[model samples]
Target: AISRWPNRVDQRELRQSEIYKQGMQTRRRVLGDTHVNAAEVQKSSFDAPFQELITEAAWGHVWSRHNWTLRERSIVTIALLAALGHLDEVAMHVRAARNTGATREDISEALLHTAIYAGVPAANSAIKVVKNVFAQLDASGE
Candidate 1:
């Protein structure tokens, strides 16, 4: 694979490091293995850097930090992404939310709060994504 070593890993020693393995496991746990797999699947000749940047900043740098619990980060993430219409990032955070103990109700309330401050259309679109995620998670029996 052309894209494996995450941020903060020595490019040469990542294969033998416990920290690298733990970081990837953390990424998989919070963002879902399937999502990570799909990203790997789509790594192209030119777009690999984009995915790597996410692993570095989002997963390695941000998620690896202890500033907040994953649940709180998820709440802040979903609301901010919803407000800014970062639809591309919504699913990852939603899955992270589920991993970190955010419920469907919690997501709904965050969206509601987002609506008042971020505009109804943004919240509306985000809520739709939320419903679809819950439905998919339920369908998978998880």
Candidate 2:
């Protein structure tokens, strides 16, 4: 006969887990240190839980998947962000797309493809955001 086991965990230990560490690194790398730092600095009691959730769940589990290169992920992220009208996130991902080695032409094509399904207005606004991001990148010599 087998005995049932009780489930228990230490929350502090969970914070120091390897997966959390890896997710933090990936989040910083993809979103940039400045942006990540700002988010951390601005976190409040009300939002801290939500922040942790995304860091562990979105960055750690979803982004840490090895099925695609970061470049491909950036492209797909840009498309999804644009389609969903997450324009602010789109701007950030546009910068990340460049860092991930996705060319401007590739990004433009992705937006054009998004226009077909996500609607022209969304793509138009997204294109504007991308252009602004490109300008900033160029000015920074990135």
- Candidate maximizing lDDT: 2
- Model 1 residue runs over 4 Å out of place are 1-23
Task: Residues 1-142, candidate 1: write the lDDT tens digits.
Answer: 5666555655434443444455566788888889789878988968865766666666777777788987877888899999999976787688778788887788888999999999999999988888887788889997
Model 1 per-residue lDDT at 108: 88
Name the lDDT of candidate 1: 0.79
The C-alpha lDDT values of all candidates are 0.79, 0.86
Instruction: Provide the lDDT at 59 for model 1.
Output: 71
Q: In candidate 1, where is summed lDDT lowest over 10 consecutive residues?
A: 11-20
User: Which pairs in model 2 have colliding backbones?
Assistant: none
User: For model 2, how does the per-residue alpha-carbon lDDT over 10-120 read when each residue is reduced to its tens digit?
Assistant: 454564567777788988888889889999999997897788888888889888889998888899899999999999999988887756778898899999999999999
Alpha-carbon RMSD of each model: 6.4, 4.6
